[model samples]
Target: MTAGNRCRRNVLALTVPIVAVVVVVFGFALDRWVIDSGIEIAPEPAALFPSAPIMDPARQSDLDGAHFDALFAQGIAGLRAGKPGQAAAAFEAARRLGPKVPALYVNLGFARLALGQVDAAVESFETSINLRPAQANAYFGLAEAREQQGDMEAALGAMRTFVHLASEDDRFRRRALSAIWEWEAALGRRPSNGTDAAQTETNEYAQAKGSDLLTAELGRLDGGSGTLAHFRGKTLVLNVWATWCAPCRVELPSLQRLSEKLNPEQYAVVGLSTDEDPDFVREFLREVGVAYPNYLDPGRDVAFGILKIESYPQTLLIRPDGSIAQRIVGARAWDEPEMVANIESVR
Candidate 1:
C-alpha cells in the first residue's frame, strides 16, 4: 500500500475505538441516571371508601329511610369537597342510623383518617371488620391508619389480611404485597414465603387484560385541550402521576428521557397529572423539564372514576389497538435498556 494510504488507515483504526469507547461511556452514564433516580417502593395511599353515596337496598332497609340517605349523601359530598371534618360528622350520623351497615363504618373510618383521628379511624375500621369479616376495604383502611400511627406490626398484619381477602385480580393486591415486603424489611423479619417468592419473581410490567383508557376531554398543561384518543394508533406509555408524590418526581426525568428516545411515529409517552391545580402542575412540569405531552385531570374523572387507578405513579402501557398491555405500579427506571426493551416488545 502507498505510504499515504497506510497513514490514513492507522488514523481511522485509532479514531474508531476512541469513538466506540465514548459511546459506551455515554450509554453507561444514561443507565446510571435511570438507576440512581431515587425511585421509591413505598405503598401509595389506599383509595377511600364510598367513592359515591352508599344506598344499597339491603343496607337501606336497616336504616331510618330518607334520614340515613340524606346523611350519607352529605358525607359523600363533604368528601368530594375535601372537607373531611364535615364528612366525618355526616358519616357519624349515618353510622348512628344504620349501625349494622359495615360500609357506613368503613366510610366513617376513611373520613376520620383524613382528619388525623388515627385512633378513632382504627376503631371504626375494626368495627366494620367485626360486622363483616370479609370487608376487604376495612382491612385496607386499618392498614393505612396503623402505618400512620407507627405500628408496623399491626399494619403488616392488616395489610396481609387485605391481600388474602382481596380478589386475585384486585388492583390493590399488588400494591399491598409491595407494602408487605417493605414492612417486613423494616421489622427485620424475613418476608413470608408467598410474598417473598412473588416479589423475587415479579415482573416489572404486568400484562393488563382490558382497556381502561378514558376518552374524556382533559385540559392540556401547556394550553387548549385534548383527549386520550388523540394518541390513537400509537403505543402509549401512559404515566399517571401527581405533583406531590416524591417517587413520581424522582422518576420523571427518566420518563422524559424515554419520551425523547422513542420514535414519535410508533411510541408515545404521555403523562396524566392528577393534581387539582393546573397552575401548580404547569409549574411542576416546567421545573422538572418534562416535555412529554401531559394533560390534567383536575377532578380525577378519568384517574379514579373511569380508570379505577388507586395509586399514584402508576403507568399503563397501551397497545396500538387500545388494549391495555401492561400495568406498572410504582416509580421505575423508564430509560433503562430493560424497560425500553419491554416497551419495544409491546410495539
Candidate 2:
C-alpha cells in the first residue's frame, strides 16, 4: 500500500504541543506558558517509566482528571523550570494516564524545543496540530521549530497561519504577529517554497484520513487468530487499552455495558489490549465481568509499532468501510445516554 493508504492508529491521539515566545527571541524564552523545571526523569522504557505509586484507577479515573492534572502540572512545573527531560517524562506519563490532550503535546513540544530537540519538537507540534487543527499554540510552536531549523519560508507560513487562525482573545496573537513580521523579512532575503510543504502537511490531520484494517492481524481471547477484516460491514468500536492503565481499567465496565447496548448486526464493541501478559489480561477481564469480545496485541507490536498509539483508553469508531469515524482519547462513561447517541450517530 502507498503512504496515503495507511492508517493504523492515527493513534497518533495523534496528539499535539508548546510554550514559545512569539517574538522569536531564540535565546530568551519568555511567556506564561514557557515551563519551569525540577522533576527528575527516569531512563526506563516508556511503559516502565517510574512515578510515585499510583493510587489505583478505582480512586483515579472515576474522578475524571485528578491524577492527570497532578502529573500534567508536574510537567508544566518542570518545563517552567527549564527541565525538558523531567518535563518530557511527566508529559509522556500524562499521555498514558490523562486524556490524549493536544495541549499536553504542545507543552511537551515546548520542552523539547527548549532542549533543542528541533525535529522532535516539530513532530510533537505536528501531532498536536493533527489532533486539533486551528490551534494557535501548536502552530506557534511549529513556527518556532521551523525557524530553529532555518526554514524561514516554512516558519513564516506557520506563523502567518497562526496569526490567521488565532482567536481574537488569544494571548499569543501579539507575539505571533511580531514573529510573522520578523519572519517575512527573513523570508524576503532568500525565497523558498517551504510554505507549501508545511501547509500541505498541515492540511492532513491524522484523523482526516481513513485507516486500512484488512491487513491488521489480531489475537483473539480464546486462542484464535483473526484480522480486523473479519468484522467488515459493521461499525467497529475498537478500544485500545492496557491492564496497567488505571483509566483503561476504570473505563472497562462502561465499555462492556456499551457493548451490550450495541446491535450485533450493525455494530461491534471490541477491546484490543496492549498488554504483554495475555494471561493476566484474560484473568483481569474475567474478574471484571466484562463480556465484550477482547483481543491482544502482545508486546505492543500492533498498538505502538504499527498504530503508533501513545495513550491508553483511546477509542476509535470504524465505519463499515474500515475508515475511522472518530478517535476519542482518554476514558469516557461509554454507556451514558450521550455516549449511546454518539455511537448511534456513527450508525
Candidate 3:
C-alpha cells in the first residue's frame, strides 16, 4: 500500500473506535438521566397489601373451607381491581358461606366504602367489631366510614380504638395517629383522656429525649453516602417512607413543596425509603417528582432500630443538636401556611 494510504487507514481505525466509545458512553449517560428524571421503570409486581381486610384463619375455621376461600379470594381480587361492586358481592357471598368470620365483614366494609355507601360500610365495620371486638383493621375501616359520614367524634373514637389495639409495629399505626389529630382539630377539642391517654397526649407530636441518629449512615440514591450528622447545624425534616405505602405517596408532594418553601440554609428535608429494593425506591421518587435527597434503608436499621419508627411516612423534625424535636406520624399538608409556620417555630 502507499504510505499516504497506510497513514489514512491507521487514522480511520483509531477514529472509528474512539467514536464508538463516545457513542456508547453517551447512550448510557442518557439512559441514566432518563431514569433519574422520573421515567417509569416497570416496577416489580408491587409488594402491596390489599386494602380489603383478609380473614384471620386462626380464628375462623369455617373460612378454611374451599367455598369460603374461593369467594374471599375473588373478593380481594375485585377490590384490588377497583371493582367495588363486584368486591362487595363476592365478600357478601363469602360472609354467607362463613358467617363467623369477622374479616369477611371487614372486607365488605371496605368494598362499601369504595362504592361510597358510607352507611352500609359503617354497619359492616360495626358488625365486624362486634363479632371480634379486638379486630384492629375493623376499627380503621369504621373510622374511615365515620369520617365519610361527617361524624368527627365517632371517627376519632374508632381511630383511637384502632391505635390502642394495633401492635406497636403495625404499619397503619402512624397514619391512624395522624387522622386522630385532624379529627380532634376539626372538633376544636383536645384528645380526651381515655384508654389511649398517652397516645392522645402525644397525638400532635412525639418527643425523643435522645437519639442515635447521627451515628447511622445510609446509601444515597445517586451512588453516594449520607448521614444525619451531615446536616448537623440545620433543622432536619427527615421523612421515612416506602414505595408501597399509599399515605406515604399522598404526603410526598407536600413534603417536596415544604422543602422548596423553606430556606435550605436553615433547613434540610431528607427522605429515607424503607423499600428493600433500591431500584423501586428510585423509580418511585422519580415518579413522584421528589427532588429532595433520599437514602435507602433496605434493612430498616435506621427506621425501626434507631428511630423506632414503625409507620410509613413518619416525619421527624430534628433540632440542630441531633435531638428529635417532633415526630409527625402521618401525612399532612406540609406546604400550608400554618404548617410552614409550625416548622419554622421549631427552628
Task: Name the lDDT value of residue 163 in candidate 1.
Answer: 68
Compute the lDDT of residue 106 as modeled in candidate 3: 92
Between which residue pairs do clashes occur in model 1? Answer: none
In angstroms, the error of model 1 at 122 is: 32
- lDDT (C-alpha) at residue 302 in model 3: 69
RMSD of each: 27.5, 24.2, 23.6
lDDT of candidate 1?
0.82
- Estimate the TM-score for candidate 2: 0.40
Using Cα atoms with residue i matched to residue i, what is each candidate's TM-score against the true structure?
0.42, 0.40, 0.40
Candidate 3: misplaced stretches above 4 Å? 1-211
lDDT of 2 at 217: 62
Residues 1-347, candidate 1: write the lDDT tens digits. 99999999999989989999999998899887755757667775876466787565564444475898799999989988999999999998887887776777888999999999999999999999987676777898999999999999999989887765554456787888888888888887865554583344332212121233545657787656678887888999999999878999999999999999899999999999976557778888889899898898754656664566899889999898777889999999999999999998995
Per-residue CA lDDT of candidate 3, range 196-220, in tens? 4436444432223123576576867
